[model samples]
Target: MNNLIDELTPEEIAAGDVAITSELVPWHFPMMNDNVRNDAYEKALKAALKNGGTVLDIGSGSGLLSMMAARHGASHITTCDFVEMVAEKAKIITARNGFADKIQVINKLSTTLVPGTDFPERADILVTEIFDNGLLGEHALVAIEHARKHLLKPNAQLIPCGARVYAMCIESSEIYKNHRVETISGFDLSAFNQFSSYEYSGYHIEKSEHKALSKIASIFEFDFLKDTKDESVEITFEVTESGLCHAVVYWYELQLDKDTIISTAPYLPQLSCWKQAVQLLPKPMNLTKGETLKLVAHHDNEAIWFNRL
Candidate 1:
């Protein structure tokens, strides 16, 4: 039998391991995007220090935000993650940055740790970098709500209190053709077209503006602090041209406050985990130059959601 320690990989140890009813596996593995995410954290930290309150980084991956909180002159700080390895590594990172004494690292989910109860004190500001392209798909709202209920003070601030999603049309003729399996060795292999339009992942498509394509829809934006947790949103978009509506390119801009805004959508210089969630519309809506494209964005109960046009 493989012991937990002996079975673990280096990445597993650094990312944080979790245990279910039957087995232990790594979870919340930190894939830090230094370009987009780190910059957002820096901006959020600056905003958080405006109030000069105690801070809590709900998912303190790599302790980057916690260290930023200390540097920004936060009075006190607590950082937690459900993954034990991540929390432990965050402590190391904080110590290396000379913030070990200012920030307390906890290895537990936000729900399991209660401020002024399990935690040392209530947090005056709750900061987290748990956002995905469309927000709720990553369960960012659920995590923030958990921290708000158990760990935050009466008027705690939420970083990126809200986010807006923008989407447009894209074409990938090569991608669709690559998935086509034709006759091989005198055998018919055309059955693979069934998955031809599966555009769940990101790809590098040469930027082009075909007159046949235009914005098809706008998905519902998310307000992390004010929206209901059990809600699924659907948005419809109109197609302005006639062509194969291959995919919907999505991006987001976050509103940290009334005055502070940051975006990582197309045309932005940096790319984060949100590298434009492309939804493969069911069929290439064959239309003329004036036909409208209708797209509906939906969020499933399990938090895995997508937009369709």
Candidate 2:
């Protein structure tokens, strides 16, 4: 009998002539390539563990963060992932990293964890990379709230202590193609484009592809240590340049601690795996300087969506 995990369909090879297999794990590529993100977390953990404190790592993909906590001499480290497949791999990876005894890997969601049953005590510090490009796209609000209620101490510190989401109105024909349906073969298929869908357009885009038509607007922010969060909100931005507004470009600033930070803004020296998310409007609208761009941003079921009003 063939198992699904063992199945691989012949497909075109990407980079280095390596065909992405069914066994291709999504976590590994980013974990290895995202040195900036990892370095930020590692620096903060090193400082936070200086005096030696207990740590709890949520969404502990491959147990890297938990291992980082362990490597830095945290008094104790506990990690958990929502999937059993990831948890099992993390368990083995943690051991191979010589952190088996220092860290504990649980194959369950952080929300399902109870202090008395899952650990001897609440965590003195909570660390997680539970964010997507749009910031709240991964249900960080719900998970962190639940963890605050049951998993963390009253005064626990948080790595990536805070985060902010910024939005900018843009004129990008290249981006509009991603979501809008145009005429196909000289036939009006526009009606068949009956619906629109949300998407994540990671920032492999060039600066020439899109022009910013507005000053950056701060749409959302999260202080992991203190905020419970509001998922639905409307924000307004004033156009700084006269242009056709085709999309909203959003990025994040992650405060790993007081001093370390990372951003996915396209203008930055390098882009992160969690690239800027593009929210394509239903159609292009001609916008002018000082014009209004009202946006409603919200999240449901761990997915974030943006719309213009």
Best by lDDT: 2
lDDT (Cα) of model 1:
0.65
- Could you report the Cα RMSD, in angstroms, for every candidate shown? 5.9, 5.7
lDDT of 1 by residue, 1-309 (tens): 258767765655555443532133222332354445666667777876976889888787778778878888898888887776567778877876788789999988777787667668888888877765545565677777777777788777888678776766666555445544557789986676676645454542334333326753555566767645454455545556666766666666778766667675665555444555666555455655555555455554223345543
Question: Candidate 2's residue-wise lDDT over 1-309, tens digit each?
Answer: 245324422221111123334264674567557889888889999999899999999987778889888888888898998766667767777887788788888888899998978877899888998887667777887888788878988878887778777888889887777667788789877775467665655554454488889998877777776755447888788888999888877888888889999887777676677767887777788998977878898755465568765
Candidate 2's TM-score = 0.86
The alpha-carbon deviation from the true structure for residue 38 of candidate 2, after best TM-score superposition, in angstroms, is 1.1
lDDT of 1 at 203: 41
| Candidate 2, superposed: residue stretches over 4 Å from native | 1-24, 198-201, 227-234, 298-304
Q: Name every residue pair that clashes in candidate 1.
A: 216-237, 237-295, 238-293, 239-292, 239-293, 242-288
**What is the Cα-based lDDT of residue 64 in candidate 1?**
76
